[model samples]
Target: MSDKQESIKQAAIALFAKRGFDGTTVPLVAEEASVGAGTIYRYFENKEVLLNVIMQGEMLRLEQSFKENFPYDRSIREQFSHLFIGLIRFSQENFESIMLINSHTTSRHLSDQTKCDYTSLLTFLSTIVEAGREQEVIDRDLPIEAIVAITFGAVVELAKCFNGGELTLTEDLLETLDEKLWRAIST
Candidate 1:
């Protein structure tokens, strides 16, 4: 993408994160990006298209961050710790993308392919939970999806709290959260 295109995407993400998809407008994004309204059309065919593009890009970024930080050969506890910390770090570094992604999960404009891509990240996390079950580290009675939901749901809420200034993302707090999350699922 060109610099202008990237700028437009960034501006759109900030606007969408703040105003929501339905509330945001192309002219607002263009104004924020310091580009002409027609320039946005050159890059994105329409507002929905722009939102989808931002969502897909952010999803890919999140997926890549998890894959890069995941400790494939480590113990379940260690892997979970890495994953949780990586999530917090990703949220801190890409607050706009995180908010944009959190906002767009239910959007009607997102393509089926984009939804599948997003689902794959959940599946990847589920595999980690499955590993815990296989190793007898996590509760074997609970379904894998439930385990994943509980674990991921907790972390996501914490991230949201941190993003909203309700909680601080201190290192000590992250470690405490990691331990608490592990204890929640572990046998």
Candidate 2:
């Protein structure tokens, strides 16, 4: 993509992350991007299309963060640590992306393809939880979806707090939070 297009995506991600899709306007995105509103139209047919593109791209990036150097041969505990740390690091680096992703997940503007993309990310996490359950390392009484939701919900809330300046994020804090989260799910 050209510089202007990339700028538009970045601006839209920030605005959508902060104001939400319905609260944000195309003119606001153009202003943030330092481009004409018509330029965004040139790239995306409409706001919904823009949101879909951004959501899909952000989902792929998040999934990639989880998959990078994943410990396929490690114990479930170690795998869980890897996933937790990966998410923390990703949120630290892409705060706006995470906020946008978490907030707009259920937006009415999302396309079917965007929904499918989000589901694939969840499926990846569920696969890990399933392995843990088979090994008797995860709580079997709780469903996979519940486990994921609980863990992810905690992390997302923590990220929101950090984003809001309510908490100071550090390596030690991240490790502690990771252990706490792991214990919450591990058997």
Instruction: Tell me how candidate 1 scores on lDDT.
Output: 0.86
Q: What is candidate 1's lDDT per residue for 1-187, written digit by digit as tens?
A: 7999999999999999889998999999999999999999999999998988888889889889988957888898898888888878888888878778877887888888788888987888888888889989989988987887686567667778988899988889989988988888889
Give me the runs in candidate 1 sitting further than 4 Å from their true place.
Answer: none
Candidate 2: C-alpha lDDT: 0.92
In model 1, what is the error at residue 24, expressed in angstroms? 1.0
Quantify all predictions' global Cα lDDT against the true fold: 0.86, 0.92
Q: lDDT, candidate 2, residue 126?
A: 95
lDDT of 1 at 162: 84
Query: After superposing candidate 2, which stretches have Cα over 4 Å from the reference?
Result: none
Backbone clashes under 3 angstroms, per model: 0, 0
RMSD of 2: 1.1
